[model samples]
Target chain A: MLAFIIRRLLQSMIVMFFVAMVAFLMFNYVGDPVHQMVGIDTSFKDREVLRESLGLNDPVPLQFVRFITNAAKFEFGISYQHKRSVTGLFKERLPATLELSFVAAFLSLVVGVPMGVYAGIKPDGWLSKIFMTFSLVGVSLPTFLIGILLIYIFAVTLGWLPSYGRGDVVNWGWWSTGITTWSGLKALIMPAITLGLFQLTLIMRLVRSEMLEVLRTDYIKFARARGLSDRAIYFGHALKNTLVPVITITGLQIGSIIAFAIITETVFQWPGMGLLFLQAIHNVDIPIMAAYLMLVAFFFVVINLIVDILYYVVDPRLRLDLGKANGA
Target chain B: MNKPLLSVENLRIEFPTRRGTLVAVDDISFTIDPGEILGVVGESGAGKSLTGQSIIGLLEPPGRIASGSIKLNDRRLDNLPYAQMKKIRGKEIGMIFQDPLTSLNPLYTIGRQLTETIQTHTDMTGKQAKKHAISLLEEVGIPAAAKRIDHYPYQFSGGMRQRVVIALALCVNPKLIIADEPTTALDVSIQAQIITLLKKLCADHGTAVILITHDMGVIAETADRVAVMYAGRLVEIGKVRQVVKEATHPYTKGLMSAIPSLTHRMEELTQIDGTMPRLSDIPKGCSFHPRCPECMDVCKEKQPELIDIGPTQVACWSYHDRQI
Candidate 1:
């Protein structure tokens, strides 16, 4: 068991390395860093000095090695646009994006799974037809459009929430009154809902399909034959069998959430890593952009790793029977 | 003799389809006296499993009992509500399915499943239920029952899992146990063990069984009375010895000749000429007439009603002249 896990972990590290390398190369090679670092109005001597200091004089391989080694110590160089430490810039913006994604995902699972199970169990019922119709609409509409609609309804028309920015953080610490604090939560609602809508549809569709398949498995029939209640056949037998794929889809969804939050943050004028990512791109802030890209890739790799481990834990066939040739 | 344990009269199941309604199980009727093992033998798509499932009120969707009456110890069972059916399921009539590996829930320990059934039907506390579960597991010949009760279903082998299922069926002291192809999913050697275990356990407790299978060898070895089903109807019903030794109906005769045995060695085992007709494609007269070797013109024109002949009931025009 230990050997198997160790081998899997080593493979994971190799995959993560390739992911980090690609993300690093994309931002680094996309544009000239020296011109941006020295600015548009720098003298030849100043440009030369900036180039030397920023390691533009070094080879690309050496530069990547330096970047990677510095990243290992979390000492990404200062952002030219903000004049802030790369770590500090990311630290300030990371929490809002994380919080938004977490809440959106939580809401999606809480709503989507039950809806999917209900619809799958009664595919021909009126409730199922309604849910499927809603899901189709939800899937077809873009998040940006949904975000704008939410802004129009809640902000412009109703005047129920603020249009942008992080609200009073001092009055709304971790242990504030509740989720209904005037500042932080009230500000988070619109963007979270907009982001959660599409994810909810994806989750619901995948869950419905997976649960339908599991419900048709031999084991479920066996459960029914054993005189188990309908509730037991559903939640007890079908639900657990469906969770493996659900976990994978959910993990992949987390990656997309961070990727798509860029638009959502732009729409709501929310201060998050998405906003920072846009700023880094506009000003050609290489260190910050590289750092941000690496961070996103890191999240993708880490989430996938956690999902893989969970798959092993949830299914014994994956754990005990890995040595056999993969087949049905 | 005491009252019959179970009685079914004119039981029929139908499915609504685009091509009109399909009769899955036609008007089939039979009765099991107390402590009788009635072996139901038929090929796949013969509606054998459906018969077992219908008795327990677990038929899947799209199928409905079109008309029938099921009586358990003279009590009407066909129209009882779900709650009452549940009350009878594990308490009065225990069920053992085909595959033991999938029959038990993987998430729960065997002990928990057994104890849950006990606690659901009987007036036993958690501790007492646990004790009884372990003892029941031991009675089913599971080794280290005291410790193994806490182990999940996946931990046990195929044979052991079937034993656990048997133990669960026996836990309630049910009057009739439905062992639906109980040993069909195990290895040949393990199959004997399970068959022996089932016969011995049911005998000890005076519990009747309805053993449904496609294997005639098992019926010959285990059953007291055997019912032969074809297309969805009972083709013949008689004592196991009489039916296996001397079958009356042509379908039963074909089934008997088809079983490859030491004494029956021919160029090809005398297989029934054609496939078993699908429930949707059953012919007008006798469902088996198209496939029977001794089919007559009258057999294709009129359906044969089951008639008593000596100690056997044969549903064929050839034997219809015999009086009850």
Candidate 2:
């Protein structure tokens, strides 16, 4: 198991390196970073100083080396727009995005899995058909649209929650001071639901289809022949076997959820890395963009590694040597 | 003789299709006395597995028992509510499918599966169930019974997994164990071992068995009585030895000749000429007439009713009377 985890982590590092290299090159190749850095009216001396300052004077490989080394050391330079350390801006913004994605993923699974399970068990029943139809709507409807719909329902019509913003105030300092009250939770409700809806469709469809396949497996029939109660058969044996793939898919989709938050956060104006990323992109802030891009790539790699490791935990056969160990 | 362990009569299974209702199991009837091992053999799509699954009420959608009376020791089993039928499934009649790898849950330990079955049907405590499971593992010839009970289904070899399945089937001491091609998945050598083990175990427990397979060799070695099916209907049924030597039905004779023999040498082995008709295209009269080498003019227009030929029951017009 430890070996499996270590191997997965190592594989993750390789993937991260490839993603970083590609993204860095793509960011550089898209346009002249130096030109963007120094405005059109800049002097030769200013352009040279800015180029030297940002280390754009170096070759592509050397620039990548410098970027990687500085990234590793948490020295992402200063954001041109924010006029602050790029790392500091990321550190401040990372938590809110993480918090939002985590809650959204949780809510997706909590709501979607049970609904999927219920649908699988009762495929022909009215409730199951209704849930399945509802899931289709969830899948087809965009996150931004869901956000708008939720805001309209819960914020405009019902008057039950705040429509936008993270909370009453935008706390962008050393520590977050707001977003502590019930109304704050109310304000978060729309964005969270919007974030969760997309993930919900993914998880729901995965669970439902996987569960339907599992229900047809002979083991479930064996469990049924054992005279286990319907609850035990459905949840105990069937659900556990279905979870291996469901978990892997859900885990891999965390990257997608994070990606979705870019739109979700933008829609609700939540103070997260997603909004920060949008601002950074529009203003051509290289330091902030590089830092955010690398961080997102890092997260994608880590979450996948975690999922790969979890495969061993969920099914022990993956951990054991099935006689012939490859490259032993 | 007073009350048979199970008596299934006029059992029929029909699947609804866009065209019409397709008969999967057509008017099959059989009975198992206490401690009797009745083997049901047929080629694929002959409805052997369907009959067994239907008896256990495990037949999935589209295929259902259209009209039948399944009596377990004189109690009607077919009409019972699902909740009550579930109780009777494993407690009264356990089942083992063809694939051992698939028959047991991959995620759960053998011990947990066994104990769960035991606890579900019996009043055994967890500790007692564990002890029983360990004993069952040993009884099934698994090595390291005490330690190996924690192993998952994939950890064991094919034969060992079949044994585990048998052990699970025996956990509740069910009166009838329906083993559907239990040895089919094992290698030829392991097949005998599993067959021997299942027959011995069932005999020891006096649990009646319905061993469904197409292998005549398995039937010859394990089954006391064999029922031969063709195109979803029983064509021949009798004592195994008698059926092997003197098959009254032409289809049964065709099947027997098709089984490769070490001594018999022929330039072209006698093969059943046609494929078993698809469920949708069953012949109007005798379902096997299209494939029967001895098919007669009347065989195409009239379905033969099962008639007693001495001790055996055969449904063939050729056996309607003594040879001219």
Candidate 3:
């Protein structure tokens, strides 16, 4: 198991390296940081001096090595728009984005799994039909539209929530959270739902179909014959079998949730890394853009690694195979 | 005879489809006394397995008992509510499926599976159940029962896994076991070993068994009484010796002859002329008449009911006339 984890860590390093390279490439190609920083009337010689100091004229290979090394320390220079250290800017915003994405992912799993299990156990029941219809709506409607619809309902019509922005944040050292306060939590509700809707539906459908298929397997028939209670058979035996695939999808979906938080963040104007990334794109803030790229890719790699470990834990067949391969 | 452990009277199972209701097990009746091993033999689609499923009240959806009474120790089982039936299952009646490879849950340790079943039907605590599970595994011939108990189903070979399944069925010491083609998925050599183990275990537990299979050899060796079903109907049922050596029903005779013999070498093994009729297209009269070599006009015109002929019960016009 130690060797397996070590191997996975190695693979993650390779993936992060490629993402770093992409971030580095964007620095060279995507607009000039010096041009964005300098005043419109600045002298040419002064601009050259400023560029030189920023190492813009450095050799490509040396600059790439510097980019990789500096990125390792989370140093991405300054955001052009904010003129603040890019890492510091992201550090302030990281907690909000992380909190939002996690809550959304958690909500998706907590709500989706039971719904899926119910729909699966009784595919033709009226309640299943209602769940199927709701899932269809969740899957078909775009995230932005859903966010707006929620805003219009809860914020505008009902006057129940704030339409935009993180309501209020409490800071604890480096981490900031909106959940500890009432208005802040109410503000979080719509965006989190909008961000998590598609994923919840996807998880529900995947789980439902998987549950249906698993229920038909011979083991389930045998389980029934064994006179196991309906509860034990469905949740204990059947649910555990469905989880291997669910874990794979949910892991990837969580990665996408963090990456795709941009849309929800923009819809609610929740100040997070996504809003920072979007503003970076508009002003060609290469450092912030590159940092965001690396961050998202890092999330993907970490999630995939966690998923691989979960597969080993949930499935004994895989564990035995790994043991055989390691001769342990 | 002492009170029968299980009795099925006029049991008819049907599957409602888009076309019409197709009869799967048509008016089959049989009884198993305590400690008796009753072999139910038939070709594919012959409804042998369905009969076993009906007895356990685990028939797949859309297929249900159309008309019947299944009694266990004279308690009506056919119409019991699911919760009530569940109490009887695994406690009063255990079941073994066809493919042992898939019968045990792949995700669970054999010990967990065994102990879970043990606890479900009994008052044993976790530790007691685990101890009982290990002993049951050892009884089924799994080596190093204590250590192997924690191993998952995939760790065991096909034969060994089937033994685990047998152990599971026998864990609670249910009075009756319905083994549906239990040896069908096993290797040729492994089949005999499993059959012997099953017979011996059932004997040891005094568990009446409904051994459903198509192998006549298995029936001859393991069963006390043999039931021959052809296309959803019991064609003949009698003592194993009488059924194997002196089958009176034409269909049973054909089935007996189809088994290859080592004592008398022949150029070819005899086979019945036609396949069992599809449920939807069963002929008006006797279902097996189309395939019987001694097919008579009367056989094609009217279905023959089970008629006693000395020690054996045969379903044929020949026996019907003799009885009259």
Candidate 4:
């Protein structure tokens, strides 16, 4: 198991290196930091000094090595748009994005799994039909449109919520969460739903199909023949089998959730990393963009590694194969 | 007989399709006494498995017992509520399914599976159940029962898995066990070992068995009484020695002749002329008439009812003296 984890860590390092290289390449093409940093009245000699100090005058390979080394230490220079250190900006905004994504993911799972199981157990029931219809709507409608619809309903029509922005936040050291405050939570509701809707439906459909497939397996039939109670058979035997695939899809979907929260963030004007990334893109803030890319890549690698380990944990067949491989 | 352990009377199973209701198990009747092994032999699609499933009340949907009474120790089982049936299952009747490799859940340890079944049907504590499960594994001949019980199903070979399946069925010591083609998925050499283990365990537990298989060889060795089914009906039933040596029904005789013999080497193995008829297209009269070599004029016009013929019960026109 330790060997397996070490091997996966090595693979993650390789992936992160490639992403770092891509982020380094983005720095060269996306406009010079010197122009963005200085005013028109600044002398050319001052600009040259600033460029040299920033290591823009260094060899390309040396600069890339520096970028990689600095990235490893979580240093990403300064955001040109905000005139603040890129890491500091990320540190401030990451909690909001992660908070929103996690809540959305959690809501989807807590609600979606049971709904999926119900639909699967009784595929033709009236409630299942209603869930299927709702899932269809959740899957088909775009995130931005959903966000606007929610805003129009709860914020405009009902006057129940704030239309845009993180309403208020309570700081717990470096981490600031809007959930601790009522107005903040109410403000979080619409954007989180909009961001989580696609994933909710995806999880629902995947879980439902997987549940249906698992229920038909010979083991399930045997479980029934063993005269196991319906509850034990469905939840204990069948649900555990379905979880392997659901975990895989849900892991990938979570990575996408964090990476793709840009539109939803923009729709609600939520003060999160996605909004930061969007503004960075418009202003051509290369440091912030590069940092965002590396962070997202890191998330993907970590999630995939976690999913692989979960497969080993959930399935004994895989564990035996892995043990053999290690022993050999 | 001292109160038959299980009895089925005129059981008719039907599948309602878009075309029409197709009879799968057509008016089959049999009884199994306590501690007796009854072998049910038939060709594929002969409804042998359906009969077993119906007895266990685990028949798949769209196919249900249309008219019948299944009684266990004189308690009516056919129309019992699902909750009542569940209580009887595993506690009163156990089932061993074909394909042992797939029968056990791969995600669970054999110990957990066994203990869960034990706890479900009994009032045993978790620790006691585990101890019982380990003992069961050892009884079925699994090596290092304590250690092996924690191992998942995939760790065991085909023969060993079948042993585990047998152990599971015998865990509760139910009065009757319905083993549906239990050794069909095993290797040829492993098949004999499984059959032996099943026989020994069932005997040890005093668990009567309905051994469903197509192999006459298995029936001859393992069963006390043998039932021969052709299509959806019981064509013949008698003592194993009598059925193997002196089959009276033409279909049963054909089935006996089809089994290759080592004592008298034959130039070629005998085979029945035609396949069992499809459920939707079963013949109006004797379902086996089309394939019987001794097919008579009356055989094609009316179905023959089972009648006592000295040592055996034969369902054939030849056994009956009636003209019509």
Candidate 5:
């Protein structure tokens, strides 16, 4: 297990390295750096000095090595536009994004799993048809539109909730939470719902289809023959079998959820990494953008590793079998 | 007189299709007295499994009982609501499926499955259920019952898994067990052991069994009474000895002769001339007429009903004229 983790970390490091290199190359080649770094007001001589200092004079290969080494230590130079440590900027914003994503993921699971199970058990039932239709809308409708609609209903019409921004968050020292206060929770609801709605359907559909497949298996028929109650047959026998695949899809989906939260964060003006990245993009803050790219890619690798480990925990067959394959 | 543990009267199973309804089991009827092992023997698609499924109330959808009444201890089971029938399933009639490979849920421990079945039907507490489950595992011959109880279904071999399924069926101590080809997927050696175990369990508990199999040898060894089926109808019903030694119906005789035996050193194995007719294309008369060596014009013109013929009930025009 330790070897497996170590191997995953090594692979992730290689992937992150490539991601960092790509980000560095992509940003460097997009228009002149002088306007982005020092603004158009800077003198021609100043731009020359900036170019030299920034290693534009060095070979592309040498420049990539420097960027990689600095990135390895979480130092992505500095946000030239803001005159702030890019790492510090990322740190300040990460907690908010983490809090948002976690809540959204939690909400998605809580709603999706049970509903999906119900729909799967009765695919032709009216309730399931309704769920499928609703799920279709959730799948097809864009995230930004959902976000706007949520605001229009709750904030503008119903006037029951706040439309935007993280409201009065309490810093619990280790983790700041918008959920800690009422208004903060209220502020969180719209954006979190907007972010989670699509994932809810994705998970629902995944779980529903997986549950359907599992339901059709021979073991399920035997389970039914065992005189298990509809509830036990479903939740105990079939649903437990369905969980392994559902969790895998959920793990793969976490990346997309985080990706969608970028738009959601912009819509709600939730002061998180997405909002920070947006500002960085407008100013062409190459350091911040590069840092964001490497970090997000790293998150994907780490999350995948966690999901792999989770597969072991959920299934004993995999534990005993994968032990031999992984030699750990 | 003691009531038959299970009784099915004119049990006709049908499957609705785009082409119209297909009759799978056509007006088949049988009874299982308490502690009796009624061996149902037939070729593939002879509806042996379908009859068992109908009894167990687990027939696949699109297929349902069209005209029949299944009574367990005089309680009508044919048209009981699904929820009520589900309640009756593990409690009243245990079921063992064909392939033990996929019978037990791989996710759960064998012990948990056994205990869950026990709890589902009986009023056993968790600890008592666990104890009983371990005992069941031991009874089924799983070594180190206590330790093996916590093991998943995959850990056990195929024979061992079938044994576990038997134990699982025995958990609630139902009056009847519908074991559809329980030994079909087993090795020849292991098959003997399982049959022996089943026979012993029935003798001990007075649990009636409807053992559905294509193997005549299994029926001869394990079954007290044998019902030979052809094209969804019972062609003969008699004592195992009578049916195996001297079958009256042409289909039963053909079935008996087809079994390869060490005593017979024949150059070519005896085989029935033709296949069982498809449900849609069942001939006007007896389904076995096309395949029977004794096929007559009367056999091809009218279906035969089970008629008394000495030690056996034979459904053939050839025997219909014979007095007991």
Candidate 6:
């Protein structure tokens, strides 16, 4: 298990390195960093000094090497707009995004899995059909649209739920956030639902189809023949078998949830890394943008690593041989 | 014989299709007394497996028991509620599917499966159930039964998995077992061992068995009585020895002739022409008439009902009145 984890971590690093490289190059193409660093009023000599200090005078490749080396130490330089370390900006907003994602993941799993299992068990039942149709809608509708629709309903039409912002007088700390407050939790519901609905569809559809396929398997039939009750058959035998794939898909779906949470956070005016990213984009904060991109990449690899570990935990067959996971 | 362990009568299984209902297993009837082994032999698509599946209420949808009744211990099982039938399944009638690899869930240990079945059907405590599970594993010939009980299905060889499956079926001490080609997935040598082990287990427990397979050799060695199926119908059923020697049904004779014989040194094996018709295209009256070498004009027009012919019962026009 240790060997497998080490191998995966090494692979993740290689992938993250390429992502970091791409993110570093993106700023060089979009606009000159020199323009943001030194205004027109600054003398040409002073501008050249600034450019040289920022390593803009050096070759693009040399600058990239320097940026990569610094990024390796979690130092993506200082954000030009905020005048704070890129890493500090990320650390502050990372918790909010994590908090939002946790709620969204919670909502998605709580509502989606049971519904998926229901649809799979009763493919023709009215409730399953309704859930399936909604699942399709969840998949088809964009996150922004869902966010807007939700705000229109709860905040505008009904005037029941809060529409935007994390919370009043929010404490935006690295560990503690608006999420820690009651009003913040209430504000979280709308965006979490909006962000999670799309993922809910993915998880639901995955679980439903997998459940249907598993329901038809010989083992399930044997389980039934062995006189296991409907509860035991459906939940214990069938559900247990369906979990490995569900966990893998759900892990991959986490990337999208975080991806969608950016839009969701922006729509609700919630304070998170995604909102920070958008603001960074407007200000042409290359350090923050590059860090954001690398962070997202890092998330994908880490979550996938967790997924692989979970697959081992859930499926004994995968744990048998160290490198034969694919062959198996 | 007073109340046979299992009695299936005029059992017709069908699958709904867009065109119409397709009959998978036509009107077939048989009974098994306690401790008796009844081998059901047929070619592919002959409904042998379907018959076994129907008895255990494990028939895949949209295939269902369309007509007739299945009685276990004098209780009607054909039309029981799904919940009631579930209770009867592992307790009254156990089933072993054809593929052992697929029959056992890969995620669970063989011991867990056995104990789960035991606990579900009986009130045995976890400790007692675990002990019973190990005993069952040991009984099925798994080496290091106590230690190996914790191992998953993938750890065992194909033959060992099938043995584990057999042990699982026997865990609840079911009155009857429907073994659907239990040894078909094993090596030829291992097939004999499994068959012997199964026969001994069933005899020791006095559990009736319906061994469904296409292997006539398995039937000759294991089955007390043999039932020959063609298309969806049981064309012949009789004492194993009598059916082997004097198969009155033409299809049964065809099956017997196809078996290789070391004593005769035949230049070539006999071939029964024409394939078993698909469910959608089964011929009117007798399904085997197209393939039977002794096809008669009436055989194609009218389906023959199973009738007694010496020690065997055959469903063929040739034996209607000893006309042959």
Candidate 3 Cα misplacement greater than 4 A, ranges: none
Those runs of model 2 whose alpha carbons end farther than 4 Å from true positions after fitting are A17-66, A168-180, A321-328, B263-268, B289-301, B318-324
Q: Is candidate 4 or candidate 6 better by lDDT?
A: 4
Query: B1-324, model 5: which lDDT tens digit per residue?
Result: 877888899999999999888899988878889999999999999999999999988988989999989999899998899889998888889889889998989888888888889999889899999999998888878889999998988899999999999998888888999999999888888999999998998788889999999999999988999998888898889899999998888778888887888987878778888788898888888888877788899988899887888898878898776857
Error of 6 at A278 (Å): 1.5
Question: For model 1, how does the per-residue alpha-carbon lDDT over B1-324 read when each residue is reduced to its tens digit?
Answer: 577889999999888999999998989999998788999998898888888888888778799899989999888888989877877887788888898888777766788778877877788999999999988998899999999998878889999999998998889798898888999889999999999999999999999999999989999999999999988998899999999999998888888988888865678787878898876678989888777778899988899888899989989998877857
Q: Write the per-residue lDDT of candidate 3 for residues A213-275, one digit (tens) a residue.
A: 999999998888888999999999999999999999999999999999999999999899899
Please report, as a residue range, the 10-residue window in candidate 2 chain A with the lowest summed lDDT: A319-328
Give me the candidate number with maximum TM-score. 3
What DockQ number belongs to candidate 1? 0.38
Q: After superposition, how far is residue A214 of candidate 6 from its true place, in Å?
A: 1.3
* lDDT of every model, 2 decimals: 0.84, 0.85, 0.92, 0.92, 0.87, 0.87
Model 6's i-RMS, to one decimal, reads 0.8
Q: What residue runs in model 4 are displaced by over 4 Å at the alpha carbon?
A: B322-324
Provide the lDDT at B247 for model 2.
Answer: 88
**What is the C-alpha lDDT profile of model 3 across B48-103, one tens digit per residue?**
99999888899989899999899998999999999999988888899999999999
Stretches of candidate 6 off by over 4 Å are: A26-30, A52-69, A169-173, A323-328, B322-324
TM-score of the second chain, cand. 1: 0.98
lDDT tens readout by residue for model 2, A178-286 = 3565666676777878888877877888888888999999899888887889988899988887888888888877887886689999888888999999998898877
Judge candidate 6 at residue B264 and give its lDDT.
Answer: 90
lDDT of 2 by residue, B56-148 (tens): 998888888899799999999888899899999889999998999899988889999999999999999999999999999898899999999
For B61-99, candidate 4 gives per-residue lDDT tens digits of: 989999989999999998999998998888888899899
lDDT of model 1 at residue B243? Answer: 98
Give residue B247's error in model 1 in angstroms.
Answer: 1.2
In angstroms, the error of model 6 at B13 is: 2.0
- My TM-score estimates for the predictions, one after another, are 0.93, 0.91, 0.99, 0.98, 0.93, 0.94
- Reproduced native contacts, each prediction: 0.23, 0.77, 0.80, 0.70, 0.72, 0.90
Q: Distance from true position, residue A45, model 1, in Å?
A: 1.5
User: 1 or 6: which has the higher lDDT?
Assistant: 6
How do the residues B191-231 of candidate 6 rate in per-residue lDDT, one tens digit apiece? Answer: 99999999999999989999999899999999999999888
Interface RMSD for each predicted structure: 2.7, 0.9, 0.7, 0.8, 1.0, 0.8
Give the lDDT of residue A69 in candidate 4. 92
